[model samples]
Target: MKTFYKYAAFAAASLAGLCACSSDDDAAETGSGLQAVAQPQIIVSDLTTSGFTLRWEAVDDAGSYVYTFDGGSETPTTDCRLEFNSLERQKEYVVAVKACPRDPAEYTESPFTYIHVLTDDLEQLPQPKITLGSAYASKTVISWTEVPEAELYEFSVDGGEAATTRNRTVILSKLDKGRTYSFSVRAMTSDATRFTNSEAAQLSFVTSDADVPPLVIAPTTIISDAVAFDIYASSDETYYYEILPATTFAKYSPEELMTAFQTYIVEYAKKQGISLQLAMASMLKSGTQSLQMTGLTPELSYVIFAFGMDLRGNITSNLSSTQFKTTADGYSAGPNYGGSDWFTQRFYISNAYLAMTGYGWTNSVWTHWKGDDVTDVRYRTLTTKLFNQVFPDPYDRQAVAAFLKDPNYGLQFNPALLSATVNSADGYNGLTEGVSAGTSYTLLTLATSSSGAETVCVNSVTTKTSTEAAAWFAAAA
Candidate 1:
């Protein structure tokens, strides 16, 4: 008969050359006093980035067992299972196990059977120290302390496309006084084995203050999937604009929207190391400058927001906006982001799993979650590749994706999921880093009870490009 003692692979990773216990090792009958014990079949369970549980078949004559990790010292255990904990992530380990007979004088110890596996990666890089070196109406200079292993620096201004430099100091020029500029710098290395891109060293600085500049931003062209707008600064001025669906525009009050936009401006400016005064002075036009947007859904109404900068480089209170509808009908309207009302319930689920009360993210998607409000439960975040593989159809919110509901299968496919799992119910707050611009990620709740089902709440965000995010995070904000 085929043995039912099955050990899961990484959802069954190919182990063509790896060794396993032979059929002779599975015999149940005990041999003579001089006979040797046989190796046991090993089963892996609860595998996580930092730890895993291992179990072995119990031999008829075995009273205890010995196990060792890598070249570490052997430990004795009477049970058929042993667990490894607090191990390093993304590293491989060798587990060797052998059985000891109930009567050691009568039976010889069994030969060791081993399993080799690599842990998952869910670690984050430390943030570097960045400061505002100098601030002027024309430009701002920012420098970050060197990271020990960093080979280069990547920084962005006003949430713009990231730029790389080997030098510690970067100059951001083009001055408009009044509004705040945000700068974000990160340390990076070519070697991913030891490090990842660091969390941004973020700082916000305001250029010198000056008088107000008159500016108006209005859409000049509106097509089915694209739109173009004109930023009328009178001469040349600094401002930011974003587009939003009409429904999203209604969820927040005017004050809330203002605060949100202001936050975006500062966060973005800090990345680039330039103030609006500087950006506008150089990037803005002598008269009106036109910016074009494409890849929008046709026939949908969008609100265009124009945020002004004061002499202090702060967001102005008197924001201006206009509404426009696309001219043609070609593309489909994608999901509207922000607010819980837009959350996609992917499956039928009972409150059997741990869930987060709320999650917040930066423009760069640096995310943190407060623990589940009700009871303590475990949860994990998935990579974009695995997350999309699980949900192929974006429109199918009423899904019956059973594989993900199975804890073993879910963890196998998303090996890194458990690396970020939170054990606490009400007091845990953790930040999951390694987010980049224009990327999508999924978060999942793990089932806690045997009788309960898991929940997959995906909040898909289609962020604008660096060019646009640098201008603003969201129009509704």
Candidate 2:
């Protein structure tokens, strides 16, 4: 800079000598035909890591100014002030400005004025604390302690494609189940040179496992009366599930849910007349994502609740659930009362020869019914019916008594009715058939409960024309 100033002073003196000695009209001096405008004195201010502002005193008789910065092309402007932005930080820059007379024929251009500038040094950014949470079989959440003045955070998993978030957290998905993973995170600014990026933070974590997999429930499909969902787990384990009215589900916390579900398991076992151990073993499911809930009543909202259970029926995992509302009746599975889908109750009786013969709608509880206990049979009535045809009004206590006594009312009364007697020690499910296209049908079945209570379960559905069944419920996202 000293060397540049020395040369500039010499040049100024040489120009003065030439102007003083000139006698011709083209001298471009005061006494000649034209005179040059005064050179502008550049003023620099507001220097920073990225940029600065430059202003020069306006020259008298000058119509405009021209200037250049950092060895860039000169930009002509009517305003004497200029702002240089988005420059590299901690770098030296040079600015040059020259004044031009309003009338070029009478006044020539002035000598160039130059100034050197160096921007302020860049600041170092501090590292953020990384936190790993909500880890599932296929995904995990990454978050960080907010850094003061941090504009954004960059994240990468196992050296894969990078992701960014203005917020403090991000979710990393499509991970392998029961696996460990490595993650790297750093804080940054939108402008790359504003502040030095914080050093990357390294973290290692393992997602939840089978016995402890966090149940992330999602609704895969929803209709007027049923909702199908899936469960996400890390390994194979049993899970107990229950769906409650939205208000009822909202009343319980995760801990409270665990306690309530515990009571349900015991009562469920007693109702099945099986040891609690056997009931517990039968309910747990194993899969990566099989989220579904059905038999939901239309126009009703519900929250499906589920949690991990040890092989012994002890609640071993935190409560995982989601909320959804069913639409108005379209097509549905039986039991419009709530959304219980069990249209056929599995019969459970041991050691005694049992044979039942009856012509009634409530298949689960008709063996012994005193007159007027008709509604009690309803427990067996509503399930998970059918048509406009005249049928037995099971709820009509007087009507049901008369119908059950008439042998003439056999299968002829309701030819569509179905009953299955299975050893249950073995299972039966090949009741298949052919059907028509674009037609709707209602199904009714009488399932005898273990306690000799008869229940009628109903399912209504319309045949679909396209797509395979498996595609509707595929792998989890």
Candidate 3:
């Protein structure tokens, strides 16, 4: 079986050689028992930029044949068809196919077949150039340069469906305000071929008018560490503030004034939160007397000012009188009083005496009462005597308690009263060294000073008001 198979393969090889030699037209002279004729013919049926397929009529008794393709050396094809890969774009390719019969007895030369494949010439359209025009009101217009081979131009705004048109420009209307729009254009060929989109041209426009002025609400006065006035404003427009130093009067626009007032009130409120309102009220009521109101809760400083404005747009500046602060309830000694200690001591003694003789007193001789002694006749007599001597009345104890809780009472002497002097070198020079009449005192002294000569002369002495002085003194004690 192996020998027979080898013989069959040898016969097939001989027939294939005969077919190749026969196509060269000199097989008969070579004495190889084969006749040479023309190369097998190949007709190209389909051609593209990538490859081409060649088909030809089959030869009789042909086992296989070889053919040349696209100027390449001859290559064999067993099926009488040749496919040339890697063809150039828009170029022509020459192709041929040969066949050989497998039966040696029937093998003969067959005519050569020839075919040429030509790739179609495709002209790519140039990129379209887009130009976005300015937008007005509710409309925006866009224009673009036309592409030479473009069958249709495509236009789109912000990735929306593209509008097809042959014209170089298109107008889009009914755009929303404050919305941004992007325009793009592309060119397409007649055969449904599309080129890359052109460089996108973009222009953004906002549809808001800047002609309106912001609205201003009424002004408000914040009585605090500093007299701050607040004004409220409302509008779509942006606003800024201008702080007026002394009064609500301002040359700035209403918006500016409102902003300034608002800022002042906020700051003043923060400073006055810890201060006693009574103290502030008293200072203001001093009526132009240079009263130094100081020793306030350092965190909360009081301010003296008149009226403020309400939301009604009416200015209440003159309508409401300026408010002042008085001493706290526990420290309510009159301004002339130095400090609360004198008053507090008196109250304390009075309260102690009342407690001894009040309704709950057990003995009059001040001796401790034993278990059964509470009902003894001697204990009862002593209790009555003590009650009459000490309490005498319940009102006295109530008054003392009330005095202790007075808001005007301060632990320290009011620094506001003492005249302030920046320098205090000499004991007496007819001029106090440091004295300030404002809420706080500062001492000042000229440089000239000697030990015993009294060269340290003080001038411009200021003192705290009576109310402030009393408050400071009480608080210090």
lDDT of 2 by residue, 1-477 (tens): 232343345434544443333224324455555667887766565455556666677799999987777668878989988887777866767666778789887787776666666655644355665645456655565556555446788888888888888876566667776888888888774443445456678998887675334666655455665666656566775677778989888887888888877888789999989998887777666555554554457788898777888767787777776677876534433221111222332221111112353211111112111111111213222211233232444233334334433455412212122222132322233222343322234433333334544444333334332221111111111
| lDDT tens digits by residue: candidate 3, 67-182 | 76655787766775666666576675555445545664545544434444554343334445444433433434455544544678776777888678987656566776556666
Off by over 4 Å in 1: 1-33, 121-477
CA lDDT, candidate 2, residue 248: 85
Which model scores highest in lDDT? Answer: 2
Model 3 quality (TM-score):
0.21
**Candidate 2's error at 309, in angstroms?**
0.8
Scored by CA lDDT, what does every candidate get? Answer: 0.53, 0.54, 0.35
RMSD of 1: 23.3
How good is model 2 by TM-score?
Answer: 0.32
Candidate 2: residue 204 lDDT (0-100)? 88
The Cα error of candidate 1 at residue 110, in Å, is 0.2
Q: After superposition, how far is residue 1 of candidate 2 from its true place, in Å?
A: 70
Q: Identify the runs in model 2 with alpha carbons over 4 angstroms from their true place.
A: 1-213, 267-273, 289-292, 333-440, 443-477
What TM-score, computed on C-alpha atoms, does each candidate reach?
0.26, 0.32, 0.21
Model 3 worst lDDT run, 10 consecutive residues: 342-351
Q: How many backbone clashes does candidate 1 have?
A: 28
